[model samples]
Target chain A: MEFEIEKIAQLSRLSLKPEELKKLRKDIESILGYIKTLGDLKTGDIEPTSHVLDLENVFRKDDVTRINIRDEVISRAPCVEGPFFKVPKVVDKE
Target chain B: MEKQLYELTLKEAIDVAKAEGPWEIIRAVIDRTALLNPRLNAFVRFEPEHFLKKSRKSEDFKGVLSGAPLSVKDNICIHGCETTCASKILRGHVPPYDATVIRKLGDAGAFFLGQCNMDEFAFGSSCETSAYGAVKNPWDIERVPGGSSGGSAVAVAADMTIAALGSDTGGSIRQPAALCGVVGLKPTYGRVSRYGLIAFGSSFDQIGPITKTVEDSAILMNLISGFDPHDSTSVNQTVPDYTKALARNVKGLRIGLPKEYFVEGIDPEVETKVREAANVLKQLGAQIKTISLPHTAYAVAVYYIVAVAEASSNLGRFDGVQYGLRAPGKNLLEMYFETRNQGFGEEAKRRILLGNFVLSAGYYEAYYRKGQKVRTLIRKDFEEAFKEVDLILTPTSPTPAFKINEKISDPLAMYLSDIFTIPANLVGIPAMSLPCGFTEKGLPIGVQLMAKPFDEEGIFRAAFALEQEIRIYKRKPKL
Candidate 1:
């Protein structure tokens, strides 16, 4: 199958130069060529192991113990207004 | 004072700090780091003043790692310090809170030396991919230090720090440790908490120790391994005093030699030394048997798909919205594209792209699903093997440190470096790399020992026994 480099980069929120994409295409092809070997393995009836641990549904008591690092966190924003992280507007004005 | 402190192990340093003082020792490490970091590039960022202030109160503290300096991998957050993950994305960013491990280490009185360099977002096997520039191996400056924990390993190897913390998501810790000729342990997947570590592949990621000796790895393991309410994956199992597991008797211990690890691509010297190490274990009364982990060949392929799939999701948070580098853009989507494009290194982009492709529509079943199913087969290989043997031993890396740029262009070759170490991460087992021998060229080689889940004691016992039988730990690379 042909790998769609541009589409994948767009989906991944990355913008690569044409030259860089050309090089990456070759590398990705090589990597996927190797990865395709997994298809040859007989994995029938094998349960997909997403996580190794058996622990599940971990719960913690609801409490007002959260640390107030809001100011500290907002301070790291590239652009901030008061305690808010400023970002470009998502909606277009009609 | 520097020479004396450099010679002492983590255990010995604590004793000396208690008897004498920690000021001189702390200053010596800082001085050594200052002296060597220029050449080794082992650190991404260091705060000498902050370290000096902390060391002043070191004498009054009473913890097992008291006053011993530890260089942390750049990915682990340390409050008020740069946690760049050796990438441009986190440029000018300082974490507001410490990782759970950092807090634990501080509570234990371990002094923070600085932030060590690593593969950008822990993406590469060699440190070459780091935005901070490649960290040179202390053994041979011309060769690349195995990474993404390369800086941490180099720091310990060069005596720039007593020990360092490195996260392993597919051999980041063990590979570098082996290449640097230090003892590195990747504890059981859930053994160490992952609360503060910058996530690479959350399922496989673990924070482990890179130290000068096997006992030092145990010492650091005791301090870090435990259940954290903050991390859901962290097991509630009783954390054992790992130091007690350092008993040298491996008698009656069944060790398995996986035939697949000693394949054609493995360096002859590494194979010879590891075989000698297995023999040494046999002479020490442990039973050695040839074993087959048939699915081992599929590990690297499976790991890349699974790791990148998870990484793509994990790294999606770095979209220039909350913190980290933000490129100017007319809209939010453009901003994310620009920021990531300018922020991430080449390898990080490649992995993110590939990860997204695997999880993309029409391809998920063929790639991601198949990868996870084969991941089960890989895990089952260990499960079946562990039922018959107490531990599995193999060469930590196929070869010693390769010359810088030797395999940088070929990502596949770089991925192959982790062939022996990746399986343990896949299975969630505890594994370690300790010095076994060196090549005739003086480059260090290490043998890997893996144990069943939460059986850190088993791996520690076997490693300690082999460590005692082999005196290779005494040899230091002359910087």
Candidate 2:
């Protein structure tokens, strides 16, 4: 039951300390070990159930019915600058 | 000699409000909450003045639930109020708009008392993972209130609020309600709108009521269950007046006791109480039969894989973005990693990592896809069984409320606590947990009643019948 805890954490965009990574590896292994029982079930040719109800694409009249809450939404951001969300620079400076 | 206003059931409080006015009822609950909340830790946020303002405005709204004091799980957005999902990542993230259920509750005149505590991102069976703190079971403060909706259940059980709303994505509602000795209903998937609920397991989540009695559950369901254009998945079916389903008769109704649920590893008392509940229903003219949901053994495994996969994807939006917590870093990816790493609790991190692992490229077919396929088998098992029985019965939890720190370290053990309740969420059916009896140590035990998808009416009728016969609702915790 080998698991790449660091790789998974990196994929999940989560930083983990060495000790935390060690613990998580053991925990995920046992959890995955238990989850391995699913492999025994003969689900061959069975259609996957993503949603229980037969969901069709829901459409509505193409009319503007939503109220604009721009300020209200922007007010909740951790870093806001005049109605816009401020984030760390994505590109490196030359 | 009369009951305190805070101690009255939702129906009784409503009746009293008809003559006495709604303010007095609100005050009683406010006072009760102020007095008991220090010990219970049920509410993550309880501001007396905030409730007073809502109650004042509620005076003019003459809706069906005029002036009812309710506690909401922290995950559901309340517009202008912090909706954190009990996770630190979203600590200050107030929503710009109300969740559809909040709007519905407001229109019906139900005012919120405060946000209740829960497992961070509704990840654990024990409410221990909440960022605010663990919600102590009203029955025994040392024991955990069943989780994700633990605080909601505690508030109802302890009379902190008349009734509260909780979201169930694998028994977040019913399991806690059972451990706390109250009524918890997880309505059919898409039966209740999930418009404002912070996503955990999208396909499985449904917000329902936790209340002191079955009738209160019915009353709350009527107000909240409906089609919502806001939530695309919300079913467009006609919502029934669930209050009409509380007729005190289970005459000739067939109830199935799934043989798989009654197996070993269940607490002897829980098994006995559930069986006793079945007999009580049988005595009242319902036909009782033994049935099997053969795929039951794989439910917990399938649920963790499928639910966490959905949860991992749904949670990706919280990466130092438009709202919630942001971490400083030289690079954007570093900020994303730092924010999530610092923000999520241990349980939340574990689930997120597992979720990504299963959905990762090579392992997708092995874990996530297999889980989805096996989930179909679990659903088909119920579909076949429902043809023979009107409702399925089982213990809501394997045992009574456990000590606070008992299984928090053991994630697998904690996951198994939801074994019986997980199948209902996996199958997307309506199920309710009602107080059936108590263990010798005075801890509450719950028996579950599950009905076919969209048939909450059947569950109500049968549960109401059992509740009336047992009169367990009359027994309150001596907190």
Candidate 3:
């Protein structure tokens, strides 16, 4: 029942206002309370099922197939510079 | 008669297109959509001029569904069209290429009608969570069409399009289809390629059809079901001609009625109608038996844990640098925080938070791993029951659609609505919802049919037979 809503939101890369944090805390508490029902059934020996089918190591031939959608993909970005997506400066200036 | 062309099912429209060409049908559907969309809010983006222009050139196109108008859920990619998943963050993100299903539909000459609205990030069971606004149920405008795929079901129910494609991750397709009195199928997980579906619980998501008739669903399954090398999870199993499965014969078929699903808390009317559907199948020479999926009680809990954990990982891509909305910030980390905080709706944020909490360091072993292990048990329950029956029957939703704001504020109540439908998604099996009957207030009820993994043909065989016997699909809402 004790959820650190601010910490979770921060981990999720989401900024939450104070009121929003309050509401999210209440909702997450109730949802987690419901989710706690899974503890009743013991799954001691069962293997976890990540994917239903037993498909592994699905490697395609390394041959290159030309799909030229550079402009189309780049055009959707919110900020774009010539042939590259523009982003905020990450490194600190010396 | 031409004015009612929008009412034609996908098969009927295909035949009409062959004789009269695709223009008349296209124009009829466009006119119908224009008239109905304003009231229903089913379409987020409808382009009459675009469809008309395409219809003009479709005269030379030929295929099984040649020139049939198709409505796509906003979550599915269409090369140049905005695929937003009905959320603010993805509002203007247009994909550079089509989803594999979209490509197949295009090759089959199915002209796009437009994108239908959905719950933001396919999160809510009621359509109220859609950022565009809630889609009103055509059955009763005050009520909600069930969520996530609500717009697709509404579009098909109101005859705004011949057929629509909807992705089901925990009953997104079937729940809405049931509420709207249309047929919806969630194919076996790997039966259809997931190359272009915007991921929401990657293991649970599967794109399928919502249509007026079971036969139309079969036609779409034929076109969209296949292995795509692009999606490694798509099974290499051979895709059968599903239309051939619509033989209307359930004689000697084994149908199991799960005792857990028929218990208390279900609307009496929904329970009765689903039981009646089982009897109808029984009378048609099929054997009906009582079955137990004992782990059913824990399906919702397990689904919430596993699905959200996967979704949180999949949704990590939505930072400001790429597609969609960008919020201003001084630093790179601040940019991500601002963008996500602004982009996500309340429900999306709640789910994302829950996802992060469950997968966070100390909680990982208890929540995520435990949920996955229980998921194995749920799958085993179905595997054991399939040994007794070819298909399992249950109610698609606990009740017919509720009032618009009824469960919007209460997230737990909304999650419980999908209790019967979630197990199929959890187990990666094929399941469907078809119109069964109506309530006293005229709301439609649907009965669910679930089959073993890769046994969609069995589902079609039983559903097509019940559909023929009951004829519930003939009833339509006066929108």
Candidate 4:
């Protein structure tokens, strides 16, 4: 039941303060114990439902107008300057 | 305590206020919202003038929610409006078009209230991750409202908005709705269109209602509960007017109690309250039966794996190149790296990284595929249980609302809050939470109702039955 806050943080990609880590560990361990209940099941043949519809292919007739963005045909660049979508540089390197 | 404006149900207020012309309801809501914003922080964005203008433009003028105010969860896109999903990555990202559901609501003459706050990227179980401040519970300002849809729940509970449309990922909608003592519905996946809902694990996401009463939830459900041609995932099946079904009654409907859900961690008073609701249902003529969802224990782990894996893939669009907020750098990779680094909240980054880690080349089979396999088992559990009964009933969460700092420290604990609600999403079944009863301490408790696939009507009927008996519709938070 030792929740590794650093390990979970590393796994989760959080930059946490030194103060927050101690509290996070205890909370996560209880939660992990709770979620661990899933390990007890014997589920081999059940077909998982990723989507409600078992059917595939939402084919539409070619005549139907579905978002004909101007960029599809008229794409050189809307605001390309020197091989980039130009904007002022943000996020200065510290 | 004496008929707090914060506690008044929208219908009761409607009687008192008399009529809703000139956005009277919205004005009263704004005054209340302004009062609660400092403590509750429910609304992420509120624009009075723009919202009032839209409020006055209701075409039908006599439609179900006409003049009745509604808030959109920040994740759903509104044309010419910001939908950041409480994520910095999409900060200032205004959608070019309205979500199909939004269009339907607009056509039905519902007033537009501001976008409410949520967990960043719809990733958390509590309202702690928004770029804006976390939303607090109306019952207790220091506690977390269960989230990704937490703000939607808070708004409805606090009487800031009559109803809200929130997207459920895992248990985003129902969990918070349970926490805040409101009715939240997660319709069967594909029952509602995902066209305008910003993606967070697309297969598992759905948009539904958070409301003060079962009736409000039903009315809002009728408005947004249709298929859209724009989304391939939207079912081609006809969407029924759910409000009609609310009056059908749940008498003789079989209510199944899964043995596994009742065994552990669930608060005793929550159990008492849930049992109380079950007893009331029994008194009202529904048969209460003990049923087995033998594989029920594995919901959270399986859900986390699939959800994070899908999230990792779905969230890949946030690189610095094409759309949304970007932190520029010399080259694409640096720009991509920097933007994501500064943009996403800690929890969102955690899930994305977990998603990436789970979907990582070597681990995919063990975590992702195995999780999907377990997901099948969880769905099988529900399917089997449903055969023995018409609907399943359970406590919406193992515990009542928790203090703000209670679970923020642990990602796993936050994920656990969605335990009861996740299996419904995994199975693509319709589930809802209604205010069943409260603890002696007065914290609200919620009871969940789940129906077999495409049986949202059964869900409404069942909830309406309990909603009448539980009768918390009249209760208000003291905030």
Off by over 4 Å in 2: none
Question: lDDT of candidate 4 vs native?
Answer: 0.77
Full candidate order by DockQ, most accurate first: 3, 2, 1, 4
Q: Against the true structure, what is every candidate's RMSD?
A: 1.4, 1.2, 1.3, 4.7
Per-prediction TM-score to the true structure, in the order listed: 0.98, 0.98, 0.98, 0.88
Q: Measured against the native two-chain assembly using Cα atoms, what DockQ does each of the candidate structures obtain, in the order listed?
A: 0.85, 0.85, 0.87, 0.24
Model 2 chain B, poorest ten-residue lDDT window? B52-61
> What fnat does each of the candidate structures reach?
0.87, 0.87, 0.92, 0.28
lDDT of 4 at B245: 80
TM-score of chain A of 1: 0.89
Better structure of 1 and 3 per lDDT: 3
- Highest-DockQ candidate: 3
- Residue B106, model 4: lDDT of 75
lDDT of 2: 0.91
Query: Model 1 shows how many backbone clashes?
Result: 0
Q: What is the C-alpha lDDT profile of model 3 across A52-94, one tens digit per residue?
A: 8867789889998998899888888999999899988899799
Over B1-479, each residue of candidate 4 has an lDDT whose tens digit, in order, gives 46644345545544444463525566777888888877788898877667555546544445555556678899998876778888877876767778998888877666677899999988888889889978899888778898989999998988887778899978888889888889999998888888889899877899999888887777777778776878888887887887788773667889998877797799999998888888888988899999888666677888777887788778777764555666756755556667776787777766675666666666666567778878777776777887889999999999999998788766787777877888888888999999888888788899999998889999888888778766786777876
Cα lDDT of model 3 by residue, B1-479, tens digit: 34488889999999988777777888888898999999999999997566556444764447877788899999999877888999999978988888999999888888888999899989989889988999999999999999789999999999999999999999999999999999999999998999989999998999999999999999999999989998999998899999999998999899999999988899999999999999999999999999999999999998889899888888899997889999998989999999999999999888889998999999999999999899899889999999999999999999999999999988989999999999999999999999999999999999999999999999999999999999988888997
User: lDDT tens string, model 1, B315-415?
Assistant: 99998878789999898889999999999998998899889999999999899999999999998888899889999999999999999999999999899
In candidate 3, which residue pairs get closer than 3 Å at backbone N, Cα or C atoms, i.e. clash?
none
Residue B166, candidate 1: C-alpha displacement in angstroms: 0.4
Residue-by-residue lDDT tens digits, candidate 2, B1-479: 77888998989988877666677888899999998999999999986576465545645546787677888999999877878988899989988889999999888877688999999999998899998888899889999998989999999999999999999999999999999999999999989999999999999999999999999999999999989988999988999999899999999999999999999899999999999999999999999999999999999999999999999999999998888889898888999999999999999889999999999988999999999999999999999999999999999999999999999999999999999999999989999999999999999999999999899999999999999988989888997
